[model samples]
Target: MPTKSGSQRKRTALLLLLALTGCALRVPVRQLRLPDKLPPEELGALRAIYLVLRLADAETASPDKLSRAVALAAEIRRALEGPSSRVVAYQITASDEPADYFIEQSSATGVLWLNLPATEPDPPPQEVDASTATASARPVEASLKAPYHFYAEPGHRLILKDSVSAAHKSTSTAENQRALARLLAANLAKDLAVHPMTLHRVVEEGGEPELKEAYQAAKEQRWPAAVTLWKKVSTALSDDWTPLYNLGVAQEKEGRFDLAQEYYAMALERENSKSRPRKSTLRRLRNILATLNRLAPSSLEPAKGGAAHIPAWLRQKMAVLPMSNETVDIEAPQVVRAKLHQALASRGYRVLPLQEVDEKLKEIGLTDGGQLKAYSTQEIAKALDAELLFYSRLMDFRVIPLGIYYERVVQAHFTLTAAASRTLHGTRSTAQGAADTGDVVLDWEEKVQYQSVSEPKKWAEALAWQILERQVSKILKVQLKEETEILVLKCVNKLPAYFNP
Candidate 1:
């Protein structure tokens, strides 16, 4: 028989061993790793549609050039047919068949007309300095015209017309034209396809090994494996929201959107009051939900003639006028205006082409945006045959480079006005109504700044950094185009979805 003291000592030793084992087996905290670049997704309405390619000026185009265009169309078809999107099974026919014919016969949902000119436009006359009479004097570079035009109509409703040009430095016109054709086809395919969304990793320092392994699996694109690991981690750390958020991301990548949304909501519930991860998580959830709603099967149905079928906002014709430039950058206004036009069109707005608007303004002797203050909103809208007028101003556009620092600034203001507002009682002046009357429906402004700083220890490093900065600036137009796009989207989102007459 054991003594009472010895029995008590044995029990204490067993308890101590168990405590040590628990501590050793505990999972440590780990942080998530993010990718360098995030890929963009295409949420446009052109997805999963059969496309028909036809030449508008086929009678005038050369046989060789027409054949090349047909080949390019075939290439575009192959590119657009992918796992994510079977958007375009295209047919290239020289027949003058109408869009209705293809739609009825071949189940085509869209028609793209290639308006290729018979021959390249005559290059501008080269200029030579009269003072330099020597034959060695170089003539000024001549400007080249766009090689092709693409006009697209989905469901017989004209939506997009884009001119294709090549900026290739090659002196061969044929090579440039070929490049232009390929680029046009590529752009069309991109517009119609859904690209993979880039995954965003939420990193926390000193996280569990299972959590790290799950993130690594996601980075490798093994989404199923990642989900499994994330599930284990979430089960173990029920209080932690990070694993739940990651599981949502994995589910989204696997196209299980409903599951992803649920996970996101649950993660939000578990998230602490801290704003950072919560804000980011909320944004992701909203974007996914928006995408889901937009891609719904009901939204894909063609609108009928009935008022119930089409939204009131879609019936309104909007005219986006040339933006007023208050900045020193001469090209800023046009760039921003173009981006705004595309954004509105993508959102299903019936916006007039900028060219048509400009032509109408030209008829009224209004060549500049500053001159718009002279005319009433109704008069300008009537001229453009629009029910609404969108006025924009580029307040600031600049890219400044310091020793080792690069800075970009973009700022813009937008205003939407109802064209049917009654004229003021007192004033015979058309400009007075524009300034005084409360016709402005939506008004907002956005400004953004992007800066990058680097410290170089050696001459080689400094040289490389300078070169990289210059390249980035040149490629993205001073890195301000994206800022301009973001501002434009913000403005567009504020516009009323249902317009009341």
Candidate 2:
């Protein structure tokens, strides 16, 4: 029983009150938080599978758009490279290989198209003459069965819907596409690298208050408090690496590098005794060790009267000739030469660079010949302006694989002599008298075994280099103080003296 104006005003006030009430009752958004570091276990067991990635635009033959498409593909490749990439190995190939998956990035359409093997049964491989080798001749050619076109759903596809068209509209479209490609790569990596999450070990009830307190202090960035608590726990649980690791972290946070290094080393030793230490812990320890090495005084500095006062023949410019390799591997000589060069340089000797020596060898017709020693070192040295020369011969070199482990065996003989001294540096032919034989300086036989999951050639090369490195160290007469790290050995020998010096 109110007037019309009064009734309308009352209804408006009620509507306003209800709107405010609804706004107050609405739920707040939950904050999104990501883990500080992705756990390694999440990647699961590695299964070797090849993923062939090819750019779709590469087939179009459009030079105008090819550059942008190639750039996008490169971005994807960079994102895919990491430790977690153990899941899927990638190679860009046009040749028909038994590929497990094929990913084609179409930058023109801004879509990542995936192709799956067709459900239809594969055709049998056809035999062909070896001279006419092609897909038909390969045994696994059937595995390259035609793939079914996969239409990626919204989640799987990189939808740069307007970006492709915008390329014609603006010059910055290529940059936008590049940004989208990166975003897509990150999303794919995250999805593919799923692994088990590590649970925090904190007791809710009947737990040691001191341990929990230490964790809380560390979390709160209270380095001093955390260090004190962790140290007490370390004493109590002398065998545990957890408290020790925590102590190291706290010390590092507190800027006490020396103490941090000690704790980390202790933690690493303890953890290594049980099993492989955490990757993060191993990385931190290695970094700290490198830093310590940098800070430590270098022992590579030549002694006061070391090589400086050596006889001129030994002190003057030296040359290391490539070792003669009987092995089938063509790279053995190059690897040995590199190791020798590194060793010679550390001794404060003036050794001609490898390329210069190679050029001189080519000019003297010693680049490839019957025997390494057959080449006249004196003539080569005269050509190279060097007074001392090193010659080595590999008697045997083999890398044998035993299951997952690789064993590299190397046997070699070396001789260092005056490049120009006829009495000390001459070599005999089998037809000539034995009195023409050169003076042999160092002869070594190195055999080493190492376990590696990588390719056999790489593992063998690494072991071979180690053998050469140790041999060089022995020749220099320096005590190997740090076995874990290879130190450049000092040169301590009197060889071909420079007549001029």
Candidate 3:
């Protein structure tokens, strides 16, 4: 028999012990699961097959329409012949070669005819029966007309046929035609073969900061950074499947489908049955694996030889310095610089991280592009610890929009220097009367002009109608980022590859 105070103390101790035990036995609820719905694969091969693309036109079609048809056919052919495509080979011809001839001669499995219309047909008038119509009755609206029609004949029978319109309306006819071609090509490719579907990204509830940061980096297309951050989180949370699945997606985007399959399998094994994401993940993994087996069974096997040796030129560290910007767009230099860095890295060059180089530059009070010319190339190379130095100048980046006419211009100058010899390696331009003292590595410029001459009045009417109906027109005049990327790639492709093998 204990006293009253002793009894109270004993009860409190028992309650504390029970609470501790309950906490110890508690399980953590994993709030991170795949999203309920996943997007369809945007690109992949359905089967290992080939097809022939034929361009056909209506008798009443204008020369412009015929040219557009040709462009559209070319774009579709390119898409069908993409890496993930089952189309091992494709023949594009305007000749009257029968589908059977292609099948026999070109090893084509099918023929696709891209028919161009004389003109886009107007929407049919809404039908309404006035006699039987009630007050709430609505007219049946007509569907929009498509400018392009695709007919796919595989074997003896017509297998697939569809009409596709341009992705969006543009002020420029050239742009509109390009957009239409791309949209139709993408649709045709998807219909013809199996393309990889877009996957849903998982978000952890009350997750660590690194997870969120990694997600943001991935969204921005910074693959290397996203991979690093996700890897860190994966190491810390071994049981969590979100990071593993993300890793699979990243690898897949990089064309490392083998590594992607392994990661996806690991994720599925760790996944609990509480969510439906596991089902989709498993299905995707199986589809990819099956496709791989059907196409390249040898790919699944280990390579006979080890990794190839990197050349000495590629092994030497290179640095792309901050570009000198002569344009008003302050962010243009950085955008182009990052693109250049990615291009170099993809080409097997050992390029220093832009952030690290920027830090090194900052240490010496060289931040702006204008300040770069003040420092010697050798001095900058020494500061960056780089063997090779690449410099750039953004001479022109402008977009001028006047009514329905538009002009886009992008010009860049690049120079490469060997730090050890302090010598420039390129042709010296003599176009400006006085030749450049130093050899010019690259001086590239591109300009695009679009004028809507045929339907100026129609465009004006459309503009007025849009203003009255929607308060804004859907015309996009400029795409600076896309134009910049194109410029950078074209410039970098001209860079001499120093690899011997």
Candidate 4:
């Protein structure tokens, strides 16, 4: 009996040893892994949402948090484009507008509502003396209704959010018009992603809730399915960041590091600083960004010429002026001007030193560029002695419903012009008129029981600015050459590295 017991004990010890060895074989990851390039498939999906963000007067935002929000959006856009997604319009300024096709989004303290109970019509007033010509009115009686509230839960809604409409005007640019055209195509893409119009397509016909299935798939690490579902969510609902954020989290979990980062950047961009991710999440994000920076080519620099790949001929005879964006939204004008300046600088223009530029323009008797609709670029060019003209203006605006989760929207229109007539070149096209940048808009709203009651309009505008920055980055410098050179310099300098592989 003693020998048998000893044998059993030995076998138990051997089993414990095997278990320990198995445990030792598993590795612990101190940091999250991130990929260098945006996954092509994921880019394709993001490009499906043709989001047109409008520009705004950013002056009020200087003391406020708006400036950072705009920058964040721009960074996110750049990040998306790194993976090659054109979902966000190229560039942004304060005076841009949204295209007609893309739906707008906004939120309300978004409460419940009920009409007041009917009351008996007020009794006819007693006739006054002829001289008085006035009458005393009788009051009507009716039971007061209870305070009606829009009983909403604490979740986000993809569709069925509130959206308010605004009017549009005639003045717009070719770039603005192009942005409009692009938006329509993108909106269609969103619809296709949602209902899919086909059996094999990933988007479910029902709506936002349908994505719950995809969310589940992502949690299970099924990327392809999750990608499709997230696309549907993005397209079906215009500006709800909840799903996008979740999708990004799931994508990373599934080992789709590139795609995951894109989503997370966008999600974070959409969220206000107050709503930013926790430190742990940021740490994970930084780890991922560091990894991608290590992997990506470092040559991403601002473009030096027109939209075409060919660099513009450096004409000793110069011609350029500052651009102006005249948007109707109630944002401050100074912010718009500064953003435009930064955007131009990013495009690699040899701009006047900001202080000098301001003084020089003031000396020329042009206090506000937005006021002079026509000859805007010409006036600035002639005054600043900028032989090359850079002009921009704003136009139409509209607000509409977002079906994914019904939301209100705000929009703007704009154009950008770069002419070289000041040097009096024999060029016939005459670099005078502003080119259209297309419709710029921002949107947000809710239709879920689990969402907050914060007004979506502010959020909508916030999104518009965020996406606008990305648009600026894409529009200004589209040069696709290897970014290795600049990247190496940045890395060697011990500065922040570009998020690479």
lDDT of each: 0.57, 0.43, 0.53, 0.35
Best by lDDT: 1
List pairs with backbone clashes in candidate 1: 29-206, 29-207, 29-208, 30-206, 30-207, 30-208, 31-204, 32-203
Cα lDDT, model 4, residue 452: 25
What's the ranking of the predictions by TM-score, best on top? Answer: 1, 3, 2, 4
Which residue pairs show collisions in model 3?
A: 41-196, 41-197, 43-195, 43-196, 44-194, 44-195, 44-196, 45-194, 46-194
User: Candidate 3's residue-wise lDDT over 249-333, tens digit each?
Assistant: 6775565667867877776676644454567656765654454333222222121111242223465688888888889877667
* Alpha-carbon runs more than 4 Å astray in model 4: 1-24, 27-59, 74-347, 352-417, 420-501
Please name the candidate that would achieve the greatest TM-score relative to the true structure.
Answer: 1
Sorted by lDDT, highest first, which candidate order results? 1, 3, 2, 4
- Residues 1-501, candidate 2: write the lDDT tens digits: 855698889999999988856433121211111211223322222111123334332222223333333443455445434332321223322223212111111101112222322122233345666696743522221111112111122223322211111111112434444554465445443433222222221211113677778777655656578779878987886656778766655554444557766987897787667655677756766664554433312121211122343334334587777767776756555655566677667645578898898788888777742344565555666777876666666554555544335444544455555443332124422211112233333222322223345566576666666567555754663313231012111111111111111
Cα displacement (Å) at residue 64, model 3? 20
Candidate 1 colliding pairs, count: 8
> Mind sharing the TM-score for model 1?
0.36
Could you tell which candidate, 3 or 4, scores higher by lDDT? Answer: 3
